[model samples]
Target: MAIYSAERRRLMEMLHPGRHQVFSEVLSSLGAFMEKEILPLSPKLDAGEASIAKPRKALFEQGMTAIPFPVQYGGLGLPFSVYAMAVEMLGNADASVALSVEIHNAVAEGLLRYGSDGQRKKHLAAVISGKTLASFGLTEPASGSDSSTMATTAEKKGGEYVINGSKMFITNAGEASLYMVFAKTAKGPSCFLVEAPNPGLKFGKDLKKLGMRGSKTSEVIFDGCRVPEGSLVGQEGEGGEYAKEILHGARIVVAALNVGISQIAYDKSIAYAKSRKAFGKPISEFQLIREKIADMKTGIDAGRLMYLYAARIKEMGGDYTSEASQAKVYATEMSLKACDEAIQIHGGYGYTTDDLHRHWRDARLLTIGEGTSEVLRMLISRKELSRAQ
Candidate 1:
């Protein structure tokens, strides 16, 4: 049985109209790739170094990089709707891989929006081809949601700028070839492209996390790391604005990922309920079990619709900060709830180190990363109050 019903299909169609065919095709391709390649590689990557390198290399070898960039940059130039669908499908199979891919795309989008023409020509093509991995360095040990208070400083000295600070919980930190680091400059907060292998650039060991184990998250330290003056991205003092633009779009993508995870959890719970019998009958036949299923399905459907709406608003060139915040907050919380219920439905089996348990653990990270639920609530409230004023 298909998880997406006809009504859901019609809803998506109504929202996207002529865009559905391309979106469906990208989703189908991503679904097949995730099942055949990404999911199978997750266990190996989670195992150790040697095993991890193979899939990481294979992801580049395959055409997965085309999902985000424009055709001029050797990408599929796929619509944001298609990109969201592809990410949702990938997240359903392996969130770690999905996360790694998502960060790379986010960085690419940021560069496209803020990078100079020379910077784009020099960097974007390599990124789209997966020859270069980029990390966004915005969140710090001291600056998670409150970016204005970041302590990272960049000082211009003649023809170069020296950077000094540390970034915590950075995705692809050790593995990335380049980093889009934000630091307080004389003009204000500015972004600079810092290349790896620099003597002053250092990476701390990966922080052991509760979930998303296969993805590398580490701390980056810049001790007087210097880059050419030309490395600055966009206008000086606009780094925060640039970061916000990147994140507004990214929040929706994260929402799509959460929707995918929630759907998977719901499916697993439903299957377990049908197969596990109690009192000489399937647990799915019980009223309480049916109610759990109903709630899970309803939450997933609502979250999915919110994700699509946010994406549509973005594609239409609308200001969707409030909409994106709502989608991300709702979808992530819904996923957490669904995962908890899935674990409950699985009884003792879910508590073990099984796939369902892994899903539950992975689902926890979505709420905290990107932006915390508390922070998102504040953003939504602030926007509403501003509009009222």
Candidate 2:
């Protein structure tokens, strides 16, 4: 079934009545593009038969990268919900591509929320327009969730900040032209905009991964990488705050993407169960198989609702940190379960087939990438406890 014409339309109508038509039109247009340009390349992407850059550039040209930014900066200026649903569609098209684009957009989001006016005019437009791909450099080998313990440092040299540190598991690392890097300054943690081709900017070899192979993942090393004073975003010592804000928003999109993966996996399972036979009848006719299908469908629906609820709360300008964390924790775990069920229903064929198994592999990374399921659970409970007082 077409994702846009089905549950997407239903949810859009329930959440946005007056604007649903316009949203649907824009999404459908993007969906059509995905169906033609992206879906066909999934197998090739997974197998290393094709380059991700080609499809990503095609998407950029079609304006997929500028969905939620302000029109003044070359974006469509649409609501966050619309951009999120578009991400879900992209996830269904190709998980790797979706991941690469998601990280790229997170950098744009950082600049939008924290950059100076001159910085926005100079850098944000290029990023949103896809002239320059961006990466978020917040993760380090020694520090994953604890930002305060980061060892990366940025020292003020006469007219520049000399950065020295390493960022691990950075998505779109080698392919990006701009990086929103976080490091320590005298005041505290700070954010900086570091351009590529600097004397001290270097990349480690792309790390091989179990999934999302279509995207580049590598270590970014900043050995005395120097940038002008104007490269500071907002102010020195605000990087921690900016990183937290950027991540809270990103968690919602990650949830939506996982839901998309679940939807596709569930659909494939249903189709296979109907056709594959056992005991002289379709396995789908069996009670156990039917139960798996029902559970998968229910979980996908639940995940979709959770992320959409968080997105709606955010668009309304409310505090959604708890909601976003809840959505991410639930949806990422739910996608894993759903994909596992899909593989179980597919049996031996699923284990051997890259197409069927790739979904599960792709879903595995989400639970650990943005925030580990364990960490998010703790964060959610902490918020609830504080609110109770």
Candidate 3:
């Protein structure tokens, strides 16, 4: 089955109506590529039979990471919505690969937003062009959702800054060529671009995960790790805001990713409901089964529109934190619900089949990864309340 659906095309048309020709061409090409190359790898990625690097690298070569970046940085210079939709397709193709690629692109997004000229010239093009792999290193073992309370520290020592403490649950940990790490300085929290192969940097073994098994997640240890003074992306003490901004954009992409998972699960449920017979008739004819299909489709549409709206706001240079949070919270939960309903519709086969149930496993991580649903709800509420005042 095609990963990109008619509904997805219609949604794109809704965004620009008759002017979505460029978007259509790019999306159709990407969808076709994913259907052939990435979709077949989903089960193997979950089962650990294949490594995440090769397919991810192939996608990067497809300019997936470069979509929303500036053309000077070897990007396609497309809008953020294009990138978000691409991510949705990727999620349907293979959630593990999508997770890894999105984390890698997050680093690129940070550099584009906050890095200096030399930093951008040196690392930005390489990162977006797939010459180097980057990983986000903001969360720590001591600090989960509360990023401001992170324990990692960076002390200036002449021309270099010495970094200590560790980052936990870091995606692409061992494999990343560059690490976009956050640490506390005497002034305040700061962002630094730390290169790999440093003597002081070490990574813990890849953590066995509940899902997104293809991507490596581990503890990144910084024992007096040092980077040149130029490694600082933006001014010191401002990293907190930078981190927040980066995450806001990432939340939209995360929402898109979950929507992709829901689409696949919904598609599978539909096909199954038609093919699987009960009481000498297809389950699709049953009122209860039809209700499940309707609910799944509705949730998928709502989740897709939420992310797209958030992405559009972001592209317009508006404050999208509230919208981003709302999209993330809703889409992640929506994905979980859609996957669960799929399993229910599939009866015993969904419970037993690895391929069918893996959608739930993959969707489970997004609720806790970028931002917890509970925290996002609070953020949305706080923003709304502040606006009301």
Candidate 4:
């Protein structure tokens, strides 16, 4: 089956028929490209035989990263929902590449949302064009996803800021050309755009993972890391708010990503069930198997709708914090269930095969990354409670 399946088409048609056709065509063509070029690399990517940089750069040249930003900063000026859908396509192709690219794009998002015009002109276009690979550096050693407890600090010293601290589990860590670093100032948490090749900036060795092994993850250490005062992206002591805003948008994309993972796993299970024989016939004919398929499809559909709803709200310039968190929590948890069922459908092969079981391994990360389900639930409830009051 095509990566951009009929279900996706029907969903798009339901959303906006004539208006979304262009975006639909773009996604279809991109999906075709990924199936041909990138899908072949997925197994290799998982096994550490291929590099993510080349395929990702090809996507950059395809304007994948450029989709959601304003045209002025070299973006396609498309709605954020379009970009979210594109990420879904990417996730279907390869979760690792999707994860790496989304984190890179998140940095561009920070610049677009909070950076000055000069900063946007200088950094945003490069990131959008993939000329400079970007990394989000908010998660620290002591703080997994909590920005409030980040121990990193930046002190102003004679027209420069000296940063000292380390960030853990940073995606695209060593490979990123630009790092969006958040550290505390006297005021509070602040953000800085630290470029690569700084003498004081160091990267630990790449950390291996259960899945998404294709992408680089490592520790980003800053010891007396001096950057020009201009490196500060926005006002001092507001990085916490900036980080929160960026993550709120990112949660939606993460939802879409998990949906993609679920779709692929479901597709594989269906194909396997049709061929794998049972006591009398193919397992697809079995009632229990049919039930799993139905539930998987339903969950995937619901997850997609949730993210698109949140994405549309965002496009309308409304407050989407609660909606985004809801989508992230629901979609990610749904993905785990879908992927787990897929393994059950495939039975022995799913357990023995790396490529088959990797879906579960990959889906497992979304729950813990970005913001944990527990944390996001609290956030959604807090937002709703405030609204009600």
Q: How many backbone clashes does candidate 4 have?
A: 0
Residue range 1-389, candidate 4, lDDT tens digits: 88878878787777766778888887788889889878889999999999998999999998899999888888888888888998998889999999999999999999998998888888899999999999999888789766799899999999999999999999999899899999999999999999999999999989879888888999999999999999998999899999999999999999999999999999899999999998989999999999999999999999999999999999999999999999999999999999999999988888999888888888888989999999999999999999999
What stretches of model 1 exceed 4 Å from their correct place? 1-12, 43-53, 60-63
Worst 10 residues of 4 by lDDT: 10-19
* Candidate maximizing lDDT: 3
Error of 1 at 353 (Å): 3.5
Name the weakest run of 10 consecutive residues (lDDT summed) in model 3. 1-10
Error at 231, model 3, angstroms:
0.7
Which residue pairs overlap in candidate 4's backbone? none
Native-to-model Cα distance after best TM-score fit, residue 318 in candidate 4, in Å: 0.7
lDDT of each: 0.82, 0.91, 0.92, 0.92
Candidates' TM-scores? 0.94, 0.99, 0.98, 0.98
TM-score attained by model 2: 0.99
- What's the true lDDT of residue 75 in model 3? 90
Give lDDT: candidate 3, residue 133: 95
